[model samples]
Target: MKNLLLIFFIITLIACNQSVNKISLDIRVDGMSCSHSCAPFIKRKLIKTEGVLEAEVSYEKKLAEIVFNSSAISKEEIVKKIESIADGIYKASIIKASTKETNLKKPSSLNNRESLDFNLTKPGISHSSGFQLPNLFSLLNSILK
Candidate 1:
C-alpha cells in the first residue's frame, strides 16, 4: 500500500508540472495591425525567455499564446516580458492561464505557417498583405522608449 501511494504521489507531481507548461494572454497592442510586421519581435522575445518552449502571436486576434516550463518560470514574469516587448506599441495583460491549451502548433513549425509574409509590398497591416517586420520593430522600439 505504501508503494502504491508513493507512485501516485509521483504521478501527481509530474502531472502538476506538465500543466504549468501552457500559458496564454490577450495583449492590447497600439501599433499591431497584421502578423508580418509585429509577430517576429514578440515571438523572439517570448521564445528567448528561460522556460518558454513555444510562443505564438496573432495580429488579428491580438493575442499571444506561450508554452513554457513552469519550474523555470512563472506567469507574472511572462506578463512582464510581454509588456516590455509590446512596449508603447502594445499593452499586454494576462487574460488567463489554465491547463487548457490555447495554441496547438510547435515552435519548429512556426516558419511553415501562412501568416508570415514579410516579403510583400504592402503599406499597412492586413490579412492578404503582411507588414514590414524590420521597420516595424524599429518603429515599435522607438515608440516604446
Candidate 2:
C-alpha cells in the first residue's frame, strides 16, 4: 500500500509539471493572400505539429497564435515549422510570447476558450516618414493660389 501511494504521488507530480511547461506564442505570418485557403492550411499544419495544444490562424490579421508544451518543442522549432510549410513560401516572425500555468485541478471545457491579450505597440505612439496629410493639403492649396 505504501509503494502504491508513492507511485501515485510521482504520477501526480509529472502531470502537474507537464501543465506548467505550456507556453503561448504569437507569430506574425506573411505571404498569405486569402482567408479561405491560406489560413485554414496553416491552421491544419499547426494542429498536426507535435506538442501543439492549440493553434489559431487568421489570414485577415496575418497572425498565428499557438500554445504548446515547452518540454516537447521549443519556440524556434515552431517558427521553423511554420516557415517550412508550403515549400518555404511563408515567413514567420514572433510577435509575442508568454508563459501560462494551466489549472489542472479543474477539467478544461471545450467551450471555454481563453483569449490572449497582446499589445503590439506602445499606446499613443505614432511614427511618420516626414510626410503629413495637413502639410500635403496646404502645399496643394498654395500651389492652386
Residues 1-145 of candidate 1: C-alpha lDDT, one tens digit per residue: 9999896576555444443344544444445657787877777777667666567777877777776656567888877777676445657777767655565455443532233434433567444311211223333356569
lDDT (Cα, tens digit) per residue for candidate 2, span 10-122: 65554444332569888999999888899778877876676676777879889988877686679999999999999999999999888963332122122112212233246
lDDT of predicted model 1: 0.59
Q: For model 2, what is the C-alpha lDDT against the true structure?
A: 0.68
Predicted model with the maximum lDDT: 2
TM-score of 2: 0.58
In model 1, the runs with Cα more than 4 Å from the true position are: 1-34, 86-88, 111-145
lDDT of each: 0.59, 0.68
Worst 10 residues of 1 by lDDT: 128-137
Number of colliding residue pairs in each model: 0, 0
